[model samples]
Target: MCKAVFFKKLKYRRDVLGDVIVNKHKCLYCGTCVAVCPMDAIELIDKWVEINEDCNDCSVCAKICPVGALGGVK
Candidate 1:
């Protein structure tokens, strides 16, 4: 699906780490975050990514996102 359609279906959420956030519009749904999360906190479900409470805010996924989709609230 296109980015616009993906954005419409997905919504942001508050996480354990107030810092880490994902811009679904920029996300490619490539599972890069899911693979790099050391705590296994990131998941790619269908078209959206979910960061669970297991996340430690290591920023590993944000650093690895090819599209620069993962980031912080700031």
Candidate 2:
């Protein structure tokens, strides 16, 4: 059986300014961020959540993360 690992295939990409940062460890793969993203920037691929470049750093995804796994780092 294959288990999901943190940061697997997910690149450490952040916006130039204060953008959304995903804490892989804290993420529950609940898809909350993906559903709440107004720009449709966050995606759940396999088991990893990917934030695409279309992200506008509005912090909507970060705000919706239930586990506090997403945030903005400035």
Candidate 3:
């Protein structure tokens, strides 16, 4: 018997940015975070906003969140 290990391929490289989080309880359902991303990495999905891998860790979204819903560790 032979054992093989394989790694999945990624289409895009992920940045080593601090964990970006959206505080759902504090979120206002506003589109401010989506509009502030220079990389076009944020989107308002129905009710909540989602951040995609396109994010460059620029912290723009975090800074723009009026309620401080979005943030990065560093």
* Number of the predicted model whose TM-score against the real structure is largest: 1
lDDT of 2 by residue, 1-74 (tens): 23344343233433435667778899999998888888998999998888877888888777778789988656
Q: Which ten residues in a row have the lowest lDDT in candidate 2?
A: 1-10
lDDT of candidates 1 onward, in order? 0.81, 0.77, 0.72
Residue pairs with clashing backbones, model 3 = none
Sort by lDDT, top down from the best: 1, 2, 3
lDDT of 1 by residue, 1-74 (tens): 99987754453334422657889999999998899889998888889988876877889999999999998833
The residue ranges of model 2 lying beyond 4 angstroms of the native Cα positions read 1-17
- Which regions of candidate 3 fall more than 4 Å away from where they truly are? 1-17
lDDT tens readout by residue for model 3, 5-55 = 221122212222364677889999889878778889888898887777677
How big is the positional error of residue 57 in model 1, measured in Å on the Cα after superposition? 0.3
Whole-model alpha-carbon lDDT for candidate 1: 0.81
* Each candidate: RMSD: 8.0, 7.3, 5.8
Question: For each candidate, what TM-score against the reference?
Answer: 0.73, 0.73, 0.71
Pairing residues by index, what is the TM-score of model 1?
0.73
Ranking by TM-score: 1, 2, 3
How many residue pairs of model 3 clash at the backbone?
A: 0
